[model samples]
Target: MTQDIWTLIVVILVFLGILALMIRGWRNRTRSQAGLFDSLPEVPAETGEVVLGPLTGVYIGSTVAGDWQARIARAPLGHRSAGTLTAFTGGLRLDLADATVWIPRSDLQTVRRASALANKTVPGGGILVARWQVDGPDGTTEIDSGFRADDKDTYPRWEALRGDAAPTTRPDTPSSTTEENK
Candidate 1:
């Protein structure tokens, strides 16, 4: 019949182009695991902290350091009491904790946040960022670390309960320290 209808229309156009590339690669891996589990928020199990913003994006948790002693020896045999959070998006380098958070499929650049604040009586306060710029093999590493949501005396009890509205004007960068007890 016209050459079997042109070989069944070229095998149904190569099986609909391989089923539209496997449904666009399973909808881009379910939208990249739902954007890394919605960038992990709502973290406050007594003080795992994570009050707000751009918070749970960066995640490294471990690389060498014996992978943090095998995640603190599997955290009390799974009772749950381990911690880790190393981050650096695009260029690659993420090893979170509380149970996995590694992303490196290629062409990254997603961890972006600049400011965040939380200290409403420190039931696990807040702060968040994952800014990145690194080059492995011990060369370049520029990560501005400031992710202390709960621990560390909850920023001096949130600046002694924000007495003088907090700011005593002193930002010359030395990790800025001028706590006149409010």
Candidate 2:
């Protein structure tokens, strides 16, 4: 009887241990997914259009009007992926490993020059974050384009692509020019 009791306790303890490990893994995966995709809306179907490079960048999340910042877990360190941004005649399509975000050009509010966007700092010449709105089941939400090309200096070309909506003033931040010297 004593040996049976000890065996039952050991089995219970082993089961509890496995449960704890499973919970930990699930939490970790949830955090990683949030970091990668955040609250981006669904990506539209990819047409055979080719406008922008299959540029790889760290996609943060959709931007709201207020000071809604990116979650710390969603920082570049935790969430980083090589994604492609394709510009179609109708809208822009962003394809990442974790999420797909499609924004119609009509919804594009403005393309601005940012020193730091959603906690991620664009070192060399800063980065351009395009703000757009999408109407979804969660209502209308503004999305921030968190794309920084491998070549930081290519922002001007991207700005031109946006036509007159792009900001006329270039990012003249001190840090923007600092990296060029290196």
Candidate 3:
């Protein structure tokens, strides 16, 4: 009887886990696909525009009630996937394992430095947050690009493309004093 109870409990837990994953996936698909319009026109990348990485393996998330939730991972039972971010002369492209997003210069609103994304904190101002608009099912809506640089060297080019001044200083790097102390 005890063995049977243990099996039943294990089955129940597994079922709950699956349910949670399904819910997460459904929510993620809704948010990401909400802005996809088949009629939206495409813009071509300009010549001589710098390509700042296929910054690989970055976590992408969306905002919900003013907080960020990572969409889903491309693993079993999850729909969120690691994505690549590329900045070019005209705008930014986010290539996910399952989909791709194009944010043109006209659609861009602002780009700023950040220290954290989703639920994870990235030390230093290592993240580049882009707030932009896209064509959704309901018309235009705003979206945030939650990205952290794996290669710091690419930041200047990205800033320039965003038409923002190169930061006078960056906070994500360890301070000289902190380095000395260490």
Candidate 4:
């Protein structure tokens, strides 16, 4: 009985040590990412008219643009959570379970299809990647945030957000219409 107790204690100690190390590593990563926190845009008081969404999905997380593995470790950026993606005349809003991320329309670069981003892996073309730029102390950083819809059919509709469908700005007066709403 004593021998078993000693072995169990040793195992527990080892596990706790590993846990501590992991916590320390994550803390360091968050600190290293502090600079990026300022670059994230402030959530708008209003997001304007909804152009698309209330699309249900998992927010796979964001990363330095083009580097699928380099997850942004800043608070709220590097974590996976259930989320709703909405497109508005103002831009895109990621209503994450834990945090809300607002990306202005002007910041959008493109929206693409992807399978892997940050630490999450889904099937090919399972994720919608919104590539956008954020201004920071380092000039501008382009980042890609991934979202996977619960309904697969929603993918194409979200993709439309990248093209002519997602206008960067609400037209003061849409040329198509005789008089656009201000």
Among these predictions, the greatest TM-score belongs to 4
Worst 10-residue lDDT window for candidate 4 reads: 173-182
For every model shown, what is its TM-score relative to the native structure? 0.20, 0.54, 0.59, 0.83
Per-candidate local distance difference test? 0.29, 0.54, 0.55, 0.76
Q: What is the lDDT of residue 44 in candidate 2?
A: 54
**Candidate 2 at residue 136, lDDT?**
40
Candidate 1 per-residue C-alpha lDDT over 127-153 given as tens digits, one digit per residue, 9 for 90 to 100: 322222223333322222223332433
Error of 4 at 51 (Å): 1.2
The worst-scoring run of ten residues by lDDT in candidate 2 lies at 167-176
Q: Model 4 shows how many backbone clashes?
A: 0
lDDT by residue (tens digit), candidate 2, 134-171 = 45443454445566666656667566555223222212
Residues 1-182, model 3: lDDT tens digits: 69999999999999999999988977777556544333333546462374677777564454321233433222211333577787776777777676666677666665665665455556676766665655546455444466665676676666655533222212322222221121
Q: State, as a TM-score between 0 and 1, how close model 3 is to the true structure.
A: 0.59
Query: At residue 118, what lDDT does model 3 achieve?
Result: 50
Candidate 3 clashing pairs, residues 3+ apart or interchain? 72-80, 73-80, 74-80, 124-172, 125-172
Q: What total of clashing residue pairs does each candidate reach?
A: 7, 0, 5, 0
Task: Estimate candidate 1's alpha-carbon lDDT, on a 0 to 1 scale.
Answer: 0.29
Give the C-alpha miss distance for residue 7 in model 2, angstroms: 32
